[model samples]
Target: MNQVLTQKPHDMLAATLSNEMAAVNTLIQTRMASEHAPRIPEVTAHLVEAGGKRLRPMLTLATARLCGYSGDNHVKLAATVEFIHTATLLHDDVVDESGQRRGRPTANLLWDNKSSVLVGDYLFARSFQLMVETGSLRVLDILANASATIAEGEVLQMTAASDLATDEAIYLQVVRGKTAALFSAATQAGGVIAGAPETQVDALFAYGDALGVAFQIADDLLDYQGDSTATGKNVGDDFRERKLTLPVIKAVAQATAEERAFWMRTIEKGRQDEGDLNHALALMDKYDTLSATRRDAMEWVTKAQDALTALPNDPIRQMLHDLADYVVARLA
Candidate 1:
């Protein structure tokens, strides 16, 4: 299997998994509807139709097919993965007070916070219903635990967001809880549905976990370096938001007393003014925190690629391998 570094990784996966993805899409539409409330579908469609990459669900379909799964259950599982992801986005927008998502108005902004929160809950319930239809307790356990971990991670971030005391370890804990939990569960449940060997299933979980970490690190790094037109975000959005991501965490660890005061004034007290973003970038550059963050992201990418060696050597596996690299490649 030749590794493809030229193409978009998920696009390649989508081409290969087109049929399965269609089924997942149909299932998502069917399950997202509420007969009593037209408002439910309207709110759900606003976000669902917003053109976000369906990466999480695609991982489930890819892993299941890679493991030679032939059952229709993977379709249900893929939709379940999507529902969980959509639900999270709804709640996160409300929590983050985000006005925009994927370059469009967020559901909370379009409708209301109450609509966003309740629709998120509705999707969550739909997810469980879809998962239960699979009749695999192990699958249910993985997805259920992932849901809990994501909620816990969000809570942890709330406490750790502005605190300078947040170290890389705590940051990783939050990432694992909020992001990697679903990624791991998506791949793990896919393998479980295929009845793959225990080792392969564990490997799938590990791959998803590492990939999720790298994916998030790259996203945080982008907040500092990405083109606003391309990312649909201004540079240092996270800084203005006062979220203590890895680059800032690294910079804080190496901050001088004067630099510490700057971080405290801007990040801790939320008293940012003109030139603060530039100063934050300067300090991060002085400590080489962006490079340090990139290094950590690449390490996770390596971990993700290494995990793939445990699975069958095939086209899907190769695509997964490239997907790991492509995640961090955005930083370059």
Candidate 2:
């Protein structure tokens, strides 16, 4: 994707967001390069150099700046969050057996799984050390709890995948675990580091949680209908992998006997050597699973906007508020 063209946004705020994201690229690069470990930079850079939105770090920096933070600690906090995120991607690639990420081979694909695992661990340790430098036990507490939640969420996803019995409640819990926890931590840490009032901190966290939920929901919906170029992953990866996402769960909620059997055969039984992909797509369309999931994502986008109403009405905060809306708009 052309990074320069990202400046084209329907709303002016998105333009600024594009620039803010670009501004953090260097900070991310410098922090990921380590002088000590011989291969640490290579592994860490493998993940970091692969372009992510850097959304987590941007959230930290934008929140701190929006809240009138004058000190430079937010930079450290932002870099810390990026490190944590990169670590998760390394571990996640190994767990998912993913060959491609950001259109490049995954760390586990380029090197051995052992190397990816070890590098991920080292990044985690480096993140902890970075947090300690801030001297804010509160920040550590928030991130430590977030780290645990992220791990538990990943475990939940692993266990839940291919489990036909998975329901809406379980899906939401999994989403919170896998995506919302880090988003909440990133924004909450911003407020905590910036010394924002507790109420504002709470508001930022609530906003982030809702935004993350909507983002994940959109992702689930797109797995069924998104352009492969835009999303980078294949259309049926989630389905083929047997992970029951929101769309499938919603469809399953109202599935008939044959549709249920179809799901069982394709998703659970893994008997998809035949043309099950077409059958699964037809079933998803018949049930309007894509539409239903998209609606859920939109609802959360509204809820996310509502959460931001309590924040001070400033350009930055309002942009963030708009950002929540922007996240799901593309999927629409």
Candidate 3:
């Protein structure tokens, strides 16, 4: 009701997501606490309170609740999802050398990478404990595969950076591996715990994968299009890092000999000057890469909604459908 789902002033998708996420806040809190280690609470609380949309865990719980699941495992599953997400954030800061997150100085910036990495390890271990408590090997397998895929994706992103030869196919693989894998696992596990029919379970997985891919692509597009105050990151931070995103990748695919020389000198070599950013963006516009990337993102959102057609016509399902549209529509 408060419309706090997004930091964006006009974004309704984030608002819808916020409403669903608000329902799971209590579960997130109760499970973030630890009895055995006093340090666990302080470290975990510091990061949890740092603020996130809690989208992953919210999907887990919302999907489970939508399926008429009456069991309490949704609580643990949701918490487990958050822990995994937080762990990734912590490690991501270390890897990216990022000093800020959620518009605040990051954990690594505040306490140093050592603390961030160690605390992240603790959360990973704790998440495993929560999953084990569920006594569901099937759940374990899903999360375990996600963890491996996440690690692999991170490494792949690192390797892909500054590679002028990177193509759109590899870019999509990186997105799926790094971003969508966990989302799919989170939603799929929700249906699994609900013991939903196999068809519905598969649908949830497809729904999440498409939504996550669209979400990441939208975020990438926003880097070139969004207001700096709203996104909480500097415009073109990806460009600053010489990272190849969808727009840049698409632009590269169509670059002429002269345009390729500019990209190789700037994005690939990190030889940026003041006007170089505008020049890079000009190339993206020249090749219609921004529009193309946005089209791809919308297609994924459509696919995500199609996956949800199997869900019953309920308020919750409608909310998810609207949320998918909202994720990509923000850029428009």
Per-residue lDDT of candidate 2, residues 24-125 (tens digit): 566666656677776888887777767677777878877887777877777778778888888898899999999988878998989989988999998888
Off by over 4 Å in 2: 1-27
RMSD to the native, candidate 1?
Answer: 1.3
Q: Indicate the TM-score of model 3.
A: 0.91
Clashes of each: 0, 0, 0
> Candidate 1 or 2, higher TM-score?
1
- Full-model lDDT for every candidate: 0.92, 0.81, 0.83
Better of 2 and 3 by lDDT: 3
Clashing pairs in model 2, backbone N/Cα/C closer than 3 A: none
Give the per-residue lDDT digits (tens) of candidate 1, residues 55-139: 9999999999999999989999999999999999999999999888888889998899999999999999999999999999999
The predicted structure with the larger TM-score, 2 or 3, is 2
- Across 1-332, the per-residue lDDT of candidate 3 in tens digits comes to 12324433223333544644554566556666677756556766777887777778878877887787888787788888888998899899999999778777888877788878887898898789888988889889999998998898889889997898888888888898778999999999998899888889999999999999999999999988887788888899999989999999999888899999999998888898999899988999888889999999999999999999997677678777877877876787
Residue 166, model 1: lDDT of 94
Order of candidates by TM-score, top first?
1, 2, 3
How many residue-pair clashes does candidate 1 contain? 0
Please give the range of 10 consecutive residues that has the lowest summed lDDT in model 3. Answer: 1-10
